[model samples]
Target: MKVQVNSIRAGNVIEYNGKLWVASKVQHISPGKGGAFVAIEAKALREGNKLQERFRSGETIERVHIDERECTYLFKDENGFTFMDKETFEQLVVGADVLDEDQSRWLQDGMEVTVSLYEGTPVGAELPKTVVLAVTEADAVVKGQTASSSYKPAIVEGGIRVMVPPHIGVGTRLVINTEEGTYMERAKD
Candidate 1:
């Protein structure tokens, strides 16, 4: 499907230069002397090559259609991460080459993920916007550092490091934003 370049967003797959690329980041820039344009950083789907391009807001681009399926993360082993289809109970073993390391690290047991399929082949998976993880390690709060804007480095479940409010400590359950890998707030449950 053809769409305005300005409409492109991160995670959307598009065909550029006869190759399929997934947009990793998108930024809209409007300089003082030039018309607005969308800057995109994309990674090749099959070969994993990366490309950065800029497109005028008025230009159109080819966007590839990908099928998204709801799947539950089963487990990980030598074959890579395995997920079960919620509807058919079919199992899919997505290799590391297909699933980026950043995306795979966020997977938790039984977590619901949206698997992106191109031509029935799994390409990428999207985790929930926020995940609840218990802090495994946190830096000690220094005296007089209780300012509201202060944040400390902490390691959460899965060994993901995030900057959290100073009040957060080991064993605290925190809600983390998966997109930016940042702390949101204390997990209520």
Candidate 2:
């Protein structure tokens, strides 16, 4: 399918320069001196090479079709990540290289995720936007640091460090944005 440059969005797979690329970020630029165009940061679907391209308004690009399947994350082993199809219960093992850094850390057991397959092989994955994570270690609020809207570095359930509000303390269960690794809110649990 052909889609207008302005219509491109993150996660959209587009064909450019005779190569298949997945749009990771898209920005619409409207400068005072020039016509509008879309700036895209795309990664090659097969080779994982990243590139930036700009397309002028009214230009159309080919959109590649991908097959997505709903799967439940099982566990992470030395071999790779394992998942079971939600519908068929069939298991699939995917390599770590296929997932970006954020996805690798945020993936939790039994969490539902979308696996994108190309030519019957797993090529990509879509993780849930928000996840509940327990704060493992949060620095004690320094007396003077509280004067400003300061944040403290803390480690979460996955052993990844993130900047959190000063009030957040150890053992706090907070809602986290997996993509940005930012704190959203305190978890109800």
Compare the candidates by TM-score and give the number of the best one: 1
Q: Give the Å error, residue 61, model 1.
A: 0.6
lDDT, candidate 2, equals: 0.87
* Root-mean-square deviation of every model: 1.4, 1.9
**Clashing pairs for predicted structure model 1, backbone only:** none
State the lDDT of candidate 1 residue by residue for 35-149, as single tens digits.
9999999989989989999998889999999998899999999998999999999998888876778778788999999888899888778789999999999999888887558
**Would you list the C-alpha lDDT of every candidate in the order shown?**
0.90, 0.87
Estimate the TM-score of every prediction.
Answer: 0.93, 0.90
Which structure among the candidates has the greatest lDDT? 1
Put down candidate 2 lDDT per residue, 1-189, tens digits, no spaces: 998888887777889999998888799999999799899999888899999988899999998888889999999888789999998899988788777676789998899999888778787788899999899998888887777988889999879898998999999999999778888999997
Clashes of each: 0, 0
- Candidate 1 local lDDT, residue 144: 89
